[model samples]
Target: MNKLSLTRRAFVTSASAFGLVGASGLALPYYSRANQRPAFTHGVQSGDVDATSGMVWTRTDRPARVMYEVSTTESFADAVRLAPLDTSPASDYTVKRLLTDLAADQDIFYRMTAADLSDINAVSEPIVGRFRTAPASKRDVRFAWSGDTAGQGWGIDETGMKIYSTIAKHTPDFFLHSGDTIYADGAMKDEVDLPGGGKWKNVVMIDGKRKVAETLDEYRDQWKYNMMDKHVLALSAICPTFYQWDDHEVVNNWSDSKDLTTDNRYTEKSIPVLAARAARAFHE
Candidate 1:
């Protein structure tokens, strides 16, 4: 492997092996699941592109070894295969592989393969995606920005995040998700009362859809639920993304000094403690 590839692989390997260590000497647990055939439930996403590198992300329904191949050609005749990586419960079966040493100002096609351990011969159908590298030299670029998904009682519907599809139609080089990527702090009711005396329908997935996220699992589930939108998945497959976080990701306008006791939705009164957990989930 080249130095870039080696560096990427080493970082992931070490992280998987040691977990996230904190100043207080506490180690964050890695997510894991019972053995089963691997399945790509959430599709794929590419983001954080530069002249020579980018990040690809995916999630598997079970524990498995994730492999990725990238190429400039659609057929992948001259593809570069990265080192294989593993997914466990620690990451909630998510895998993010970094691709490096890529040509600048070029379109790249990539695909992922998961080898299911429950059955040694079982392998998943490839999940394909594409992205463009940033230009080595200064050049004009086009991109789009949006945020606040499943917010204000408007949850994901079968139509699948239609706004994202509309944005994708413009074919921007990338997308800037400006915060509120998820409303882990907001509740989505099955039927929401409108300001003008009408009802807005929402496709509810769970009973606690109206509760604020308190546990780590709840926060993770909020993300997983948002990915269920097909349009969102479709947009991600083609557009690289630069993601930023906003208050709704934890609580509305939450800060280290904010008081949670005033908010009935928050069961945890400690803003600092909740912020720490929220930050952890956001990074993962």
Candidate 2:
């Protein structure tokens, strides 16, 4: 995973550059599109960072040329522009760029620009992000790890992911997502039954939340739903993350030896076929 060390000022500036700031000087989750232009809906992220290089990722609304630019300074002076990569429907409009030949233990500022395929001159607003390379020498490093976002019957809310905001405040070098990033096999409801004849209320109507993710598109939507949270977006901008998957990404306590017929919740009895489809979505 890539490591990142961000100053509070740089974080704020980066958020501003992405047009994430509202009138209150606080980062907002959603933004209006300009003339229906391609926009970075999921924000920017970096990961798989090492001493000499790192990976950056982002998604656009439409097919376009996604350009990756890197700079030593946050101002982007004398920035090195890399070749623009084409994003198509094949990759769900997502692009991952590998930045190489980087300096060790140095803060790196990166940004992305999307240009319309038909008109190269029509470029979207830049989305800025940051990351730091691991030190070449032995050094003490600090990081955090956790998981289970938008899981169970509890879906993401405006304030539910405040833990991510708390995590961002510490400015950890990197974060490890232990598991259960999304419960693709679990169906969400407005309320769930409790032991004492009570109810567990949940925020509902989220895309792909009400039903199981059977198709690849459904599986992808499970991820997109979590990105809608501002806290997740903010944490991603400031902290690099390494992700791992758990059974919930496919099904609860799923294993190669387990029988699909045992689970009444699953309509498809073929575990191998379901696992194959789930793996493709997970890797993507």
All-Cα superposition RMSD per candidate:
8.6, 8.7
Best by lDDT: 2
Candidate 1 residue-wise lDDT, 231-267, digit = tens = 8888999999888988988888775467766676564
Model 2 C-alpha lDDT per residue in residues 103-194, reported as the tens digit of each score: 89888989888866655445689999988888899998879899998777877643557888899899888999999988888888887788
lDDT of 2: 0.77
TM-score: model 1 vs. ground truth: 0.82
For model 1 the local lDDT of residue 36 reads 42
The positional error of residue 224 in candidate 2, measured at the CA in angstroms, is 0.5
* Alpha-carbon lDDT of model 1: 0.76
Show model 1 residue runs off by greater than 4 Å.
1-37, 204-208, 256-259, 264-269
Q: Give per-model TM-scores.
A: 0.82, 0.81
List the global CA lDDT of all models. 0.76, 0.77
For each candidate, how many residue pairs have backbone atoms clashing (under 3 Å)? 5, 2
